[model samples]
Target: MASSTSYPSYKQLKEDFVSNLSGGTVSEIALVCAVAPVVSLLWSTLQARQSFFKPYTTLGFVVDFLLNVGALLLSVTLYSAVPILLNLLLLTAALFIYALPPNLSRKKPRLLPDAKSRAAASAGSLGVLSTKPFLTNYRGNMMVVTCICILAVDFRLFPRRFAKVETWGTSLMDMGVGSFVFSAGVVAARPVLKERADNKYIPLGQRLVKSLRHSLPLLVLGLVRFLSVKGLDYAEHVTEYGVHWNFFFTLGFLPPFVALFQSALRVIPSYAGLAVLLGVVYQIVLESTSLKSYILVGPRTDLISMNREGIFSFFGYLAIFLAGQDTGMIVLPRTLKARKSGSQWTMLLTLAAWSLGWMVLYHLSTTYKYGAGLTVSRRLANLPYILWVVASNTALVSGFGFVDAIFFPAFYNAHDSKTEKEAYEASTSRILRSYNRNGLVIFLLANLLTGLVNMTVPTLDVSPVATMGILVAYMAVVTATAVGLDMYNISIKL
Candidate 1:
C-alpha cells in the first residue's frame, strides 16, 4: 500500500484534478438517467415471472441483486461508454417479457385480498400509506446512482463528462445532491398533503420543534463530518459546499425552515408556484448583487464567508424541495388510484408535460440571456440549476412510473393484499427495498468507504481495470451491508 505522505497532498491533488471541467451535454446526462429505470423495469419483468424465477424466495433475492444493482453498476461504469445501446438492450428485454402470456406473470399471493377489498382498504388507508413502491424505486435508484458516482468519479473508468462541473453545467453527479434533496421533499410532502381528519392544525411552533427534532441527526452528522475531515486531513473540496458547510447541514436546516411556513405550505394552492417564486427571487438577488461574485471568487474571512456556497445555495435547494413536494402531491394519490385501475397514462403524461415544461424554462433561462443570464450552476444552485434538477428528477421518476405501469402493474396492485413480510418478498427488488429502508446508513457507509479507498489506493492514478475492480468490490460491500441490515429487520433511522 502506498503511504499517504509519499504522494502530493491528497486534498490539493484531488481538487486540482476535478476543478474547472465542463459537464456533459444535457441529452447524454438524460440518457444516463434513463438507464436506472430501464434496468429496473427489466428486473420487474423478471419478478413478474415468479413461476419461472421463483420470486420472493432467497434465490429470488440473489437474482434481484444481480439484475438491479449489478446492472446499475454496469450502467454507470462499463456500459456508460455506450449508454444508448445499454438502454436499448434493457428496453428490449422488458418488452419481450411484457409480450409474454399474461398467465406467465405471478399470481396474486394468498395473503392479499381480492381486488375490490384491496381497493377499499387502499382508499381508506391512503393517508397512512401514501408512499408506493414506485416512489421507493425512484429514491432507491437515485441513491444507488449517487453512491456509485461519489466514489466512481475518482477513477479513470468513470467518464469525465459525468463528473461534477466546477461552475455551471449538467452532469450525472451534478444532479446527485439536488436530486437527493428533491427526493426527500417528495416523501416529506406526504404529511403536508394529508388533510387533518378533524380539520385541526398543528401550531407552527410545535411543527418547528418536531421538524428540528427530526433534523437533529443530520446536523450532528454534519458536525461529525466536518470535524473528521479537518482532524484527519481528508481531501476537502472547499467550493463544493464551502469550508465548513456540507450537504448534511443543508439538509438539517431545511426541515425546520420549511416547518416555519407550514401554514403557507397548506394555504397555497400551488406549491409549484411557490417554488418558482422562490427560485426567481433568489436568482434576482444573485444577479443584481455582489453575492454571486462573493460566492464564486470572494475571499473567505469569517464563518459565513467560509461557507458561502452551502449557505447561499440553501434557498435554491429549498426551492428544489418545494418543487418535489408539489410533484409528490400530484403523483402520490394518482399512483395509488392507478394501482386499482391499472391505468397510469394520464399521470404519466402529466409528469411528461411537467418535465418538458421545466426543460423549456431551463432552456429559456440559459439561452435568452435576459433574466438571470446564467447557465446551470450546482455550486450556486441558481434558477437554472433548480429548473434542471426538477426537470431531470421528475423525468427520472416518470420513467420509473412508466416501468411500473407497463411492466409490473399486477404486482403493485395485487401485492397490497399481502402481509408486510409477504409484501416485502413478493414485490419488486428486495435490494431496492433494503436500500430504501437504510438509505442514510448506506450513504454514511459509502462516505467512509470512499475515504478508506482514497487513503489506501492512488485513485487518481489507478488503471481502468483496477478502477473497475475496486468499484465492484466497493459496491458489493455496500450492497451487502444494506441487504444484511434489512435481512435482520434493522432500520438505522436518523
Candidate 2:
C-alpha cells in the first residue's frame, strides 16, 4: 500500500514555524495582560453582592499572575535591584498603613470610585491583584519597581568581554530576549493585531499611505538609529542590539503594512504566493550581485549614515509581513468554539513533528551562531527559526483548545471571550480592558521603560538574573499603569 506520508517542504515548514511563533508569544502575553482587568471586574461584582467570580474575566487575573512571574524572571536583575529594596519598603509601609486602626484610603480618599485613580498612580493600578487584604498595598511598589526597572536599567553584564559596535548593531543581544519575536511576530500575526477584517476590497494607494503611517515609527526610528551607528561606521564597529530600541524600529511599519495587506487579501492565496515569490527573488538578487552592500545600505547621504539593514530590505520584510497576514487568515478560527477532542491529539502530534524538524535544522546549522535557529545576521531571518515560531505557537493554541476540551468541566482557562467567565467584577474589567486595547502602546512604553532603566541604573555590575528581575517587575507595573491611564483617557465620537 502506498504510504500516506509527505514531509512539509522547506517553504511550508518555515511558513508554519513563523506563523506559530508570532501567535504563541503574543497570545500568551495578551492573555496575561488581560488578567488584572478581569479580576477588577470580578472584585467589583463581589463588592456589589454579585456572583463568586466574573465570567471569562477571571482568566485575566490568572494571566497577569502567571505572566508577572515570567516578567520578573526576564526583566529583573542586580543592576536595577532598587526595586527589590523599594518593594520591601513599600510592603512595610503598606503593612503599617493597612494595620492602622483606620483604612489609609478612608482618611485620604474613597480610592475605588474616585476618577483620580490611574494605573501608574494606583498602588497596584487598582487591579486588586495579590492574595490578601493588601491588594492595594502592592500598588505603590508596583510603580516604583516599574520605574526602577524601566528607567534605571543597565543592560551591561560583568565578567563578559566588551562588545564591539558592529556586533551590537547586528547580533540578537542588541534585540533583547524575545525581541525579534516581537517584530517578526507582529509581521506574522497581521490578521489579529490589525483592526481590519474587510480590507481586502480596499484600494492600493490607500494601503500604501496606510502602510507608511504604520511604519512611520520604525521608519523614523530606523533613520535615527541608523544615525546612532555613526561610531560603528567610523570605528569599524556595529551594535549587537543590546538594550537598544530595535523592536520599535522594526515594528513601526506593521500598522500600515497590515492595512495594505488587508486591502489586498481578497486573493490571499494568489497574492500570498506572490509575496513568497517576491521574497525569493529579492533574496536571490542579494546573493547574485555585490549589490548586497548597495542594496542593504540605507540613505548614505552622510558620513555617519545608518545602515537600514531590515528597512532597506523592503521586498524581504514585505514578503514576511504578507506571509504573516496570510497565516492569520489561513489558520485563525473565525469563531472560538471546539467541535471535537481529536484536535488535541492532532495538535500534540504536530508539535512533536515540528520539534523534530527543528532538531534536524539545528544539527545541520551547527556552524551558525545562536544554534543556527536565528543566525546572528540582522539581514537574514533564518528559515528554521521562523518555522519553530509558527509551530511553537500553533501548538500552543491547539493544545490549549484540546486541554480546554478534556477539562471543559474542570480547567476552562481560555480568554476566548471579550468579557470574563462571568460578570463578577466591574471596575477592574473596565481598567484592564483598556490595557488589552493598548498592547502596542504597552510595548512602546516598555522600550522607553528600558531606556529609563538604562539612564539611571548601571547594569555593568549586576548579574543577568538580577537585571532581568528588575526589568520585569518594572515592566509589569508600567504595563499595569499604562493600561490604567488609557482607561481614564477614554474618548468616544458620536
What Cα-based lDDT does every candidate model obtain?
0.80, 0.38
Best by TM-score: 1
Q: lDDT at 38 for candidate 1?
A: 83
**Please, what are the lDDT tens digits per residue for candidate 2 over residues 297-414?**
4355533234344444344445545544443443333222342344334434554464455345434433355443233233443332333333333333333333223322211222
Number of backbone collisions per candidate: 1, 80
Per-residue accuracy of model 1 over 78-137 as CA lDDT, tens digit each: 888788998898889878977787554456544444765765576443333435567788
True lDDT of residue 101, candidate 2: 57
TM-scores of the candidates are 0.89, 0.50
Best by lDDT: 1
lDDT of 1 at 3: 68
Query: What lDDT, from 0 to 1, does candidate 2 have?
Result: 0.38
